[model samples]
Target: MKRRAWIVWLPPVLSGAFLIALWYAGRAATGLQSWILPTPGEIFQAAWNEHATLLRAAGGTAVGALGGFLVAALAGLAIALVLGGARWLRTGLYPWLLVVQMTPVIVVAPIIVLWAGPGLPGIITVTFLISFFPIVVNTTQGLLSAEAPMVDLFRMYGATRWQELQLLRLPSAMPYFLAGLRIAATLAPIGAIFGEYLVGNASGGTGGLGFLVYVYNTQIKIPALFATALTSCLLGFIFVAAVSWLNWALLHHWHDSFERHDR
Candidate 1:
């Protein structure tokens, strides 16, 4: 297990090292100034200097993303439940859902920010909008994808729709639901940042990463800009890692995907 864990981590570690080396080499080769492009060392220094501000901003973004993700998860599941129940609902509403999703986030964000008053509420709403569609799609498919034999057996036993859903369909859908969450996890932080960029003005120290990105770029703080960008990537990575852990915890024992490793 230790060996496997180490092996799993090795590639990324090496890749990161290689990238750092390349960053150095590229800067040396091009003779670019720090203002135009900062070195990794310079970025690290800026991040350390701005650690308090960055940490606070990241916390605010985290709150917004988590709040939005929770709302999206609950609402998405409820919608999926309704849509999965009847073919008519699926046919009528699903197409509309597609249309809503096809609409760009950029187009809708400003409108939401205006209504929600450029605050945490607005940020959460934007995040929810960005992360909503996949969960509904996946959960609806999972509900409908329950094994026919199991569904028939429940029907034969005179089970109600709710009972069947609770006993068989939801359990079947768990994997799919988690899959959708995994995708959302990657996206929620981005939405939060975007919201911040547009309307996250409730700043005590740091408004949010997106706002900081704007600040750093306009001020020509290249190293801090890179640091902020790296922080955003780390936040997304943490969210993804959390979802992956959830998947393993929920599916490791019974899911065929993991069962092979037991052998």
Candidate 2:
């Protein structure tokens, strides 16, 4: 298991290291000032120096992001199940779902913030809005993707719609649902950060990372700005890694995608 985990991680680690080295080398070759383009080293230094502030901001952001993600995951799954179970409702409302997804988040975020109020509620609402659509889309596709022959066999056995859905469709859709979740997990932090930038209030002496980004940028703390950016990336990576782990845990035993890995 440890060996397999290393195999999973080694390529990305190597690639990221190479990229960082190249970024540093390129900046050195360009003769740019730190204010213009901070190197990875400088960014690390700044992150370490401002660790207290960064950690505080990260904690605040994490709460909002996780809060929103949990809501989206539950609501998205429930809504998808409802839509999938009813053909008439799906036919009538599916387009509307698409329209909602099509609407730019930036356009609606302020309105959501205004309605939900600032701080945690507003943050969670923004995150849920950003992360909800993909779950519905992917899960719907999966529910619809069940094999025709198998479904007919179930029907021949006089299986009820609920029985067919519970036994056949839901199991088949697990991979797709997890795929959507992984995608949404990546977006959760961005939603949280954006929410913070727009309407976040300070909690425990620190604003969210989005607010910190603005602060650092306006203060012309270039290294700190870069550090904040790196911190956001780190947060995103954690979300993704967690979902990936969940995906592996659920699917590895039976799914074709992870079959080889199981051995």
The most accurate candidate by lDDT is 1
Best-matching candidate per TM-score: 1
lDDT of 1 by residue, 1-263 (tens): 65578788889999999999999999999999998889999999999999998998898889988988999999999999999989999999998999888998788767886777677888888898899889999999999898889989999999998899899999999999999999999999999998888777644323789888888878988899999998999999999999999999999889987866445
lDDT for model 2: 0.88
* Pairs of residues clashing in candidate 2: none
Error of 1 at 253 (Å): 2.3
Can you tell me which runs of candidate 1 are displaced by over 4 Å?
1-6, 202-206, 260-262
lDDT by residue (1-263, candidate 2, tens digit) is: 76568888899999999999999899989999999988888889999999999989998899999999999989988888888877998999889888888898778777876789778888888888889889988998889889999999999999998899899999999999999999999999999998887667533222889889878877999999889888999999999999999999999888988656444
Q: Model 1: which residue pairs collide? A: none
Q: What's the lDDT for residue 248 in model 2?
A: 94
Q: Would you list the C-alpha lDDT of every candidate in the order shown?
A: 0.89, 0.88
